[model samples]
Target: MQRAVIPLKGELTVGDDYTAGDFFDSVSFRGVQLASDDNMLPDSLKGFAPVVRGIAKSNAQITIKQNGYTIYQTYVSPGAFEISDIYSTSSSGDLLVEIKEADGSVNSYSVPFSSVPLLQRQGRIKYAVTLAKYRTNSNEQQESKFAQATLQWGGPWGTTWYGGGQYAEYYRAAMFGLGFNLGDFGAISFDVTQAKSTLADQSEHKGQSYRFLYAKTLNQLGTNFQLMGYRYSTSGFYTLSDTMYKHMDGYEFNDGDDEDTPMWSRYYNLFYTKRGKLQVNISQQLSEYGSFYLSGSQQTYWHTDQQDRLLQFGYNTQIKDLSLGISWNYSKSRGQPDADQVFALNFSLPLNLLLSRSNDSYTSKKNYAWMTSNTSIDNEGHTTQNLGLTETLLDDGNLSYSVQQGYNSEGKTANGSASMDYKGVFADARVGYNYSDNGSQQQLNYALSGSLVAHSQGITLGQSLGETNVLIAAPGAENTRVANSTGLKTDWRGYTVVPYATSYRENRIALDAASLKRNVDLENAVVNVVPTKGALVLAEFNAHAGARVLMKTSKQGISLRFGAIATLDGVQTNSGIIDDDGSLYMAGLPAKGTITVRWGEAPDQICHISYELTEQQINSAITRMDAICR
Candidate 1:
């Protein structure tokens, strides 16, 4: 058995402590809050998803097809294999798996996979449990032990139920929710949360919160309502964190009991009365013309007389390789004096004009030069305008650079930035840099981001694994090419990592036939994986290395018999009768070995032949030699 612990990407904590109001750095396991893709998780937390598995007779090529369409292809060694996390259609269909052996033999089988509306044939149950001591940004002796566990279950009749509870010191909260499909209309969900808190000097307080969510896609109207939500909470309602902070002794909303602290102003904004909130997101498609979307959110607080509101809409389309987009934004603060509004437009055009026409000139390319402009005027009559240009490198969008010039109420300024994304055998990585010029003042900013994975084999550092990943193990098969990934090859340990895998979708991985060693044989040339969300899977391949040779042999100056049997050191081996040209082929030989040939069972009919090889030729494949039997 093997075990490993991996941290999720972008799940770190870097914020000011509410207790002492100081900067703090830490890590969060929020990434694991969802279902994991691998089986390493405990049984109670395992995602109940469909998977395909089988055994190959040798290193063989594997292919899976659904409804006559090839969905996955990969290579595997001679062994039992399993494939999980395949994104498949929710319909009745049989999956076909074909295994092609190195010796030209073919074998195939079928796996049944079908989905029904009333039953959860591929549904899953997932869970997560976290226990840790909360760390604050400051060293003001603020520590709390917290624990949370959640369970998600998908059942028949298009039903999904989820529930969880959390506790921290004198604070506790419980939440439950239910969701179901409405067939062609869409889906809806409802949730309820209850909390109770106790303080050493104050009476116990309890509160409840209610929320509703709705989403739908109108295929006939070409419209999609992505999200619609409404939430309400009582005046006494407090989250677990809020309760814990309120009871902690010596904690203040503003530092040192002062209301004029410069930094405390922003922190104070986070603490507010609980009342109600509404949010909506909707979009529409116009076929070849364009698409548009509208999004908005509003919140009202009980203690504060003012309310907060934000609304935005945008449209985007492409014409003859030129893409265009326009958007408008509006926002109002709870107690702000005036509301703000802005409008922006952007366009992207291919830069092929920079390339001169030649015999090898190509027409449809993706490298682009983009331009964007924005104008804004608020209720106070203040106006602003800004312009920017960007360039993107093609071939998988690995590099992008941008430059901007803007004239705002403050003044004119110019800015430039660049970013790069790369995927390597060990990890994936990204880096970005930006520079700004405001009159005589200039500033430089940069950032670096990546992920790290520690698994059964060891710890590996790379780019974000996204939702799923795979580690390939092919001992002694170093330098093997991994297809579909650019510039990815097996390392010295015959290990290569695929950092990004589509959750619940079929992903193909194959070996480059040209990179194999002549003396070695691979059982399979291709393999496929379907991974669950956030799961790390393993792919194994088998290889064999040995001496291989052919020879021309004669008995007493005459051609050997047609039915002669050959043995290596008295052990029977792969042998074939001499052809019309007096040549025979054999395999599985050892360097400097002896072979005995016998046309009959009698001892006298047996004859021995000896051969020797220099060190250099011993490791060579398909060597031809001549020997005489007397």
Candidate 2:
């Protein structure tokens, strides 16, 4: 579900009034069951998956697989591509990615994947509901309203039962599954989804898809199967997204237009249906020596002969202060002429290890620097080598810079780049410059980012905010630093905003008492807040603005009896009991005030004392004075 409000006549600027325009408020709801292999949920809720990254020398087809199962297949233009949306069959398994270049060359690499078992405690339940309209980037696509709901219940005897359904005007789907906890063996789950759809041509299609997933960890063998799964769908199976496309006008024949036109091609690509997929991700630990991992997948289409495949693995280890790694990638896609493969080696060493013998503090500080090198050779024997140095600058390590030089044997061209990043109290910034000798080409990049929060109290500038934030309010406590924050402090209004607060959980917001002004006192320095998603919660602290006073009161020539009560006549007065020395130490004192002293209930036991503070004493943080009670 989503909602937005647009001002029709007035500008909708931040920190501005929008009273003149009629607002256009819209609320939209839609629910959909994505293809079994696709998951758009956030990483936290979907569990963890390894990101597959690769460089494509030309246009290519990228396929991601795990546990011998192809989980994802897509096309990419020339350049670096990062695949972060791979849906694994299991919770743990290495991912193998294959990139088939337009020239038929293929490259493959392994991404280590591991995650905790997805076993819920007995009797626990998890559920989600979504209501929204069909959404697509293409304005020409048909749209429909839909609803979806899913449920998971942890049953008795280490079993989990899960089911879900999706409903729409023309499409409907239902799914059910069961998962088991195998104790020492591992975990496994199997599910099936049945879907029915009515196309614009009035044709009805019905099908079912079956999936199996497994995960395990062999502690003694040091082998972990993060994910291993397989899925197969019938020819008639069409996801809701696909069903919507089928309902579009002229989607089947492009309105009698040429079959070779771009419009026809778009329709064909959008209608391509999945047939079967296999994925596997695995990793083995070499005890203290290091670790290695392997991941791969294979996928096939329903109508076309094209198939996508990927395989990748790598080994990494550390020796003293030096870290080393070696990896190989292999990829192949049907219709591509040749397979692509790449071999890479990389290492890094801390400069401090070599400079520890020096006694100079500056040199020791610079020891945080690291020297790194990487070399990769393609199947055609083209090699690229890069050397770089990176180091943190400030003592807090909030500022860092790196410089790198590279040489490509294929072009015999040399290139170098330098970049710096700074994480400040209120913002983060980055700058970079890159130049290549090939064409004397130079590029400059820079960025500055921060977050602003507006609340009833006021607007506050802060570091990059997350989904949730907390606004700290401690009036009169200006310039007081926040705990656990880098150089973050309250402004003159004694207010500051802290970002990245976790939703549905308690977040501790604390102030540094030591940083408070001498004349200011805080009744509470810490507060706990729980904010909802995208919510701005206020955390208020009770702060008193006044002087601290230690006053000795006497009746006639003798000091007041101990245990006597003293109360000042002001809103911010600090009331206290007389100490053994006939003096009372109190905070939040006014410049001049009347104090009422009482000990016993008898009428004669009470006395009133009038006291005045000197200019010097009033200006001081702590004032010492004498007072007479009549």
Candidate 3:
């Protein structure tokens, strides 16, 4: 336990420094006359802060490491302080003190303490922001970009503020968006302001917008619940051709070009859930046998007006699981995109609704043969939902599923499947057919045929790296982008690391031979080459011999560099991190194989390389290309 040791005696003095926390935090000097040996407390300092007006007792400074972050340094000034509040993030840290004389010299010590979650009494705050590299195609380079920034606080309830932007190449062109919420009243977490945006050249549908999520749990784990809301303006998702406009009310960045931004407009929503058997979620439910979820949306615009609704429910109560889910929707326009509106509904369940891990609290782990399983169903049916069910019979617990589907209008549908996850291996596959009322559409579906671990190998690069995970800007949920530099190996396919918070496979970039480089001063730290892709004579790996690698370009003449990086081990799930510029300079031999290299122009140019491993050295000439690919 901590005891307040304020009020000391003796000619009190300090070198213009001696913070309240500096003194009170010291156990040995608890009762010592805090004569700063000559400085006096300023009138501006009082109350929670250590002050000296009609007072006595001096103090020393202290240091602490709650969890693992060190939160102390020498140099104190009397001011408001709290000891127990340091660990108000999750309950686990230490409290300590230090002492310094009138001189510049310093000394300090620590007192251990338990961790604590965010405490309302302490007024502590915890939050994270991410900036992502947004793209729209298989090509690694992004021509246009969209971003989101979110700030959340902790308390009895919580509060959040978020904003987004879509940069079309360089201009903050045409766009549109919206914002709103619902939750514990006054608990800002639920009822705060939110805005999704659409701007110039960008109307409602084709332009860029985003979704807002509200849940009860901080980590969104265990028996949890949440409320979800999204804004999908009817704008052209994006534009490829010039669009003329005659505004209903021409405004700056306005999407008066209804047809251009014509999308299923504004939608308001509510959701709820529970994890265990007999789980409950807003308008949806799930049980030990299986699970189900519900979702609905609508849209409105100038030239056209339409409304659609869907209520889907499903569960797996048996093996060859007899599960079912249904959906319904309708649409109508005045004279085909001129004016007027209409509404309708259709209900049916798909053949089988393949599953995924529902991030909602209403989802839970269930005992299968030997392992455990949790499932979530994709409700991306806002544009078009189908009536059918999809099933899976797994051997291990590894499999992928896919299917094609559609409803109303000229829309096409698709579904994918994954199966049998067991003993570290499983079977994953998918199948889909395009359903179009007009013409034969394309079916761009994919499925994994082999077994591979969901876990990724480590990224080991020697020191000389920048402070890892720095928020260059607030975009998506990723705060940092990690690189995989597993030494100079032929088989090592290096990949650009995204913030760990990202769904890796879904929205990530690949490192290659045409766009990787090392900083001029920091030879060990890999840098990225913009324009992501362009054929250049990049520094490919050498054979099992002394290889002088060079990444030459048709534009910048020629340059050469060598050395690979390795992934570091020991990173936890929720722990925040920053990269260490540990060991930078080292000379290593290049190996056999096509060493992929990257060379590009400013801004967009980035890199992916491995820190040559120190623990292992055999002049490894033929190494695993895992450093370049996975």
Candidate 4:
């Protein structure tokens, strides 16, 4: 149920080249991007994000330290809290917070967590700007005007910085980077970029590129390397999307013929290369039989011909019920020197732990199954096997089904898939289907995404919403029902869309008095929001429909002053006291009205009560009235 996605990607490769991409998540500092993930400091180097409010008097247990370690811990639910997803530390300490409770008590607090030198942390600033138009179908309708800008800046001591630039028409580029934090030996970064191009006037391309990065966490060798980057460029770098498609206008050059001026394309010559590159990402943990990873990349080119490499290594573990993994890969190209290796292994098992039962049955609702096996070997000798099976229908598994089979080299294959998810009452849904076979061929596929939220009582559409959301505007009541969201109701123009809130915290939104509409009058059934991250808030539920009376009055006949004061047209509506048989229960009145009752302090102790109602007593239910005060 982790929502938020705006991914739309299309790719067709195998030397055919066709690509389309779109990604999203926003709060506009150019931060937030998901569909797998992003934003690890981008937006010119992010920094300046605040919000860490708190409170909790009972069911506590919150943690959150900083310096003495322990980044965050949870379990709240008592009241007032907001922690905006932490993580920004580059020194400037101060977080703390403890709070244990549930009776055993424990408490502590602190929360300042500084940042400012490049400014960031006072509401962490991250920004991004982009403009687009880059159509291609062999460039016939030729279009190209894409722009970009990014920034991030967490400063002061452990530093952090970022920069950005880009443009099309004749090309341009800029870049900057710096990261610090050294203490026990780890964390370093450096970046540089510069580019220029002229295209049509032929010959102008300039270049400069450099990058280096490293990260660490040894903890006495139970290591955690994270990343180690490298890059270099010289041979006249040219990137600004390769100088607007290598001098556009039907790119065709041939002077000193490198096989008739082929300036690159085999999908951009395997990802933009004019000179050097290297990349590495690392990971390791292995204490309880799990964790190990290494990623790779390499490239070198000038007149091209060879020097490209790829590598991978992986391992994950679990026993006691089986789950394991292994991986290996190697690729080489520079005219391929026979390097294209692969090795793999994976296993997963969970058929309810092989029938030992005990999923806690409350009269059936638990059904589980899972099995997976994958094997591979390659470098030409070929070998592949893949098998999978999954079934989980509800019990919070949100309905699922799967089947797959495979046996290598374009032969024997089978697949089947099914998915269903629902969150009831009004929206939030997911559906999927897939089927495939080879050996005479057959294929089927389907996918649909969701998310639509509008405010002042209108559009709703559900499911996707995670970076934060709201939009429950209850205008004319409509279908009502909203209570903590899930299949949220209200539509037919009353709005609904509680999609997944929780960004700066708080979040609570109730209102299900049997889904309203009985002459409606719910002046606040509950609401609390905090939002921010990828905000979209707007929870206004002050419902109001007409005539709901319950009146008893008297003045010349005495009985008026348990606390008198009432005014309908002049607006005070109902005031203090007045209810010891001087009945009062006035909701959104107005079926024809006049109510004016006052008490003591002379002035003839005011009284003016006249009422007329029809239209079936203002639409049914609570409508019993009688008012008379001289």
Compute each candidate's TM-score over C-alphas. Answer: 0.59, 0.72, 0.25, 0.29
lDDT per model, in order?
0.56, 0.68, 0.24, 0.57
Give candidate 3's whole-model lDDT. 0.24
TM-score ranking of the models: 2, 1, 4, 3
| lDDT (Cα, tens digit) per residue for candidate 2, span 172-205 | 8888888899999899888788999876566788
* Best by the TM-score measure: 2
Question: lDDT-based ranking, best first?
Answer: 2, 4, 1, 3
Model 1, residue 156: what's the lDDT? Answer: 75
Clashes of each: 23, 38, 170, 27
lDDT leader: 2
- lDDT tens digits, residue span 245-339, model 1: 43333323322334333221122232365578787767899999999877676778766777666666778899987777776656665545566
| Candidate 4 lDDT | 0.57
Tell me how far the alpha carbon of residue 180 in candidate 4 is from the true structure, in angstroms, after superposition.
Answer: 13
lDDT of 1: 0.56
Worst 10 residues of 4 by lDDT: 18-27
Q: Residue 183 error for model 1, in Å?
A: 3.0
Q: Can you tell me which runs of candidate 1 are displaced by over 4 Å?
A: 1-180, 198-204, 247-265, 268-272, 335-340, 352-410, 418-433, 438-469, 473-480, 492-495, 501-507, 514-523, 529-538, 541-630
